[model samples]
Target chain A: MATKTKPNGKSEKNQPQSTRLWLMFPPKLITRPIVWELGQKFPLVTNVRQASVTDEIGLVSLELSGSRGDIKAAIKWMEKLGIKVEPVEINVIES
Target chain B: MDKQTGFMKALKCRECGREYPLAATHVCEFDFGPLEVAYDYDRIKASMTRSAIQSRSKNMWRYRELLPVAGEPTVGCEVGFTPLIKADRLAKRLGIRELWIKNDAVNYPTLSFKDRVVSVALSRAKELGFTTVACASTGNLANSVAANAASAGLKAYVFIPSDLELGKVLNSLVYGANVVGIKGHYDEVNRLCAEIAGKYNWAFVNVNMRPYYAEGSKSMGFEIIEQLGWKIPQHTIVPMASGSLLTKIHKSYQEMTKLGLVSDAEYSVHGAQPAGCSPISVAQKAGLDFFKPVKPNTIAKSLAIGTPADGFYALKVMKETGGAADDVTDDEIRDGIKLLAECEGIFTETAGGVTVGVAKKLIASGKIPANDSAVLCITGNGLKTLDALVGHVGHTREIRPSLREFEALIEAETKSPTAA
Candidate 1:
């Protein structure tokens, strides 16, 4: 799902960026379509690079390309749903 | 680069294949893949012969060229070469034909395999002109870094979870190293260490110096091959925490085959973990390549890494080598510790218990056939984790210091139902 473009207004937080993350869904939320929800709720491109889902848990390696503010909000929303979100490999330390 | 860097060529990213200088750095910049020390295998093959390794001192340094060090090692020089025992009794008990225990429970400087990695990391840190070294440990690594750094005259700061065993905490405190206990788990401590490592120049062994520190585990694999008469075992079982040791052991086997140290043979490298925190094994059991993180809750504190750093690599190694992964309950872990102690006279830590327990399960389930020979890596000494076995082992029979009383106790024992 794509949002309508605002042609004139742009802020620093809305600057386009791409990021990767690892999302771990607990057993309770395993059946929920969280990735689909993440896409529908946020104006971002979500691509699942890899995923492993069992009855007990769901692990997804997702790549998101969108505005920085939108990505942050999506992550916060996932966290609020009791999903554990981590950077792909904690690259900030090495960077 | 005036000093000798042994036979190491450069640090190469495992994923992106980018090369970095041979320094205290870990991950690649682009893909965030872990950087590993790439070696000059041709030179290593020319010099690292069986006879050459046999002639060196009986320690982990015998495989010094393959280890990531510059010139001679200055720290933990006498770390490894722990015994590889032929565990016939244990084999019989587990219904396996042949079994061996690569017992690092009695490893030098500290009674754990962490000494091997600490030796390499601290020596490399010294070579890189660092005056202080540090690590984020569960328990064993802190004790090893504390003891090794003290011996090397380098200041050490070890961070651990506040709820570590008393023996491990005291082991570090006695070495005069600065031990910091975090209020959270090991992953938190490690995350904080990464942030601290970015700000300070101190060599955090598992963070900045991981590429070197991880190679130290290869020495254990090398020693096993040599101790087994220059032959690789058909099956080997290793415990998992961050899962680095299992992957490094597999790498060692491959390296030896490349260098013609051992004939290329088919072998499997299995992984074991506590059931409470077995993310990798759970994924492996489900035939999945990725693992979901779990909050650890087990008596096997040393193996309680919820988010194993090398979990992906460990899974890959197991899949490639036709190996399997399994975990055991806390009760099964205690039973494993007792089985090893009673049968083979080796008192290992909870990590070893996990290995033994999983081996038993694999053997019973025929994943590891009863007819094949296997080796179980016992990584730490039992004395370090006494809290796990306080009331589990059998109690001592108390009798007064009198022959009459002892005779009466013996007579009572003979009449007991268990004796019949």
Candidate 2:
């Protein structure tokens, strides 16, 4: 008899997933120059909807929709060039 | 059914637990509680982990399992993963054992935590096919929404109180948003935004797109846990405005625990506010089930919400978490601002001052145990509201070129001991 493997909480390291791209910026990128850099990247980027600054750590959260390949490439390229890029998480409270 | 990219599920109401189709509707029909975006938790829990998150990128989106937007991002592409500094010097001054500061004042674009929420809201807005986005903000939110909207090529409309600080107005206008100076206070502007949400299909991020908007705040809490070796703090101190961020942070901690990314631990959540406008704090102080709105006459403009929509729920959370609320004076707020910068090198805005001031007060009152670790949320940068300290802060000494003259002045100043 074969025992079933329980899926522990672990990030799927080997899976190549295709999903829309979204990025959150560090506080330092909020100045005029970084905005220009972002424009150059996701040109299909319709708008930078929100910009919020906290006391010490600055974060510029951006929302853009593009192909999985282009978005993933853009994220990788930005990270390579020292730009902070991460996947946007979706949260739901079962209230 | 190509699997929607930037979104996960439907919108859920905060009060009645009613669900709505994914769109820009932020309020519910029954009792009018705010609606927020829901997600597929099983999918998120199955995929996200500490190593996966670390390997991805530095921004908040790295925890894509926790955010609402589906597919690839198109704007506000650079945000989140802000510094969670260990406040060693501040701990020494306050006589606390371990203290951390979530420094969001330096957040990119407009410099406040609002960017996190707005980024998600606006991103979802575009995905829902919205060309125009709007909001009712006091200062920081206005600056962020205007700038982000401009960059994303969306027509932006910003409605703010007429008497808002000139710096805030200028920051929003610089982004080329259609800035509307309303005659009433922020609450009036917010009410107007709600009205417009009922009449228009255009996305009002905070009003209609709030479900997605609030998800952004979770990044702050997520970063705190991740930076702390994937462990949640013993206590968290946050300033309450609309009370959304505080509630969201709690949700983040719970989610992490549920996903087994972090262990279950007892945590105390504390809230701070200016004495001039502190409904939540006052309710917490009086041990009441509800909050009584005030006229809001505080220097901490960011925390000056008289009637916070989430006030009651925030009170409930504080009670549930064994947390407490504290208030500080305007002078204390100013002193708190200077103290954090001087001790911790974190230049915080007035809202941050309230949090810091209350943190100090809580420490002195033996409320926050000296042994337990604590994290204080500093919400905005001080530079945006310098007018609050025009005549209060900085040194004004007349110096002469000659050494002899300077020595004489120094001696005189030292002897008198009354020089500002």
Say which candidate scores most in lDDT.
1
Question: What stretches of model 2 exceed 4 Å from their correct place?
Answer: A1-95, B5-7, B185-188, B409-420
Question: Best DockQ goes to which candidate?
Answer: 1
Candidate 2 local lDDT, residue A64: 44
Our model 1 lands, by Cα RMSD against the true structure, at: 6.3
- Give the Å shift of residue B252 in candidate 1: 0.8
DockQ of predicted model 2 = 0.01
**lDDT per prediction?**
0.87, 0.75
Query: Which 10 residues in a row give candidate 2 chain B its minimum summed lDDT?
Result: B185-194
Model 1 C-alpha lDDT per residue in residues B189-241, reported as the tens digit of each score: 44456557766999988878889989999999999999999999999999998
Q: Is the docking of candidate 1 incorrect, acceptable, medium or high quality?
A: incorrect
Q: Going through the candidates in order, what is chain B's TM-score?
A: 0.97, 0.95
Q: State TM-scores per candidate.
A: 0.86, 0.79
What would the per-residue lDDT of candidate 2 be over residues B373-393, giving only the tens digit for each residue? 899998888887787887778
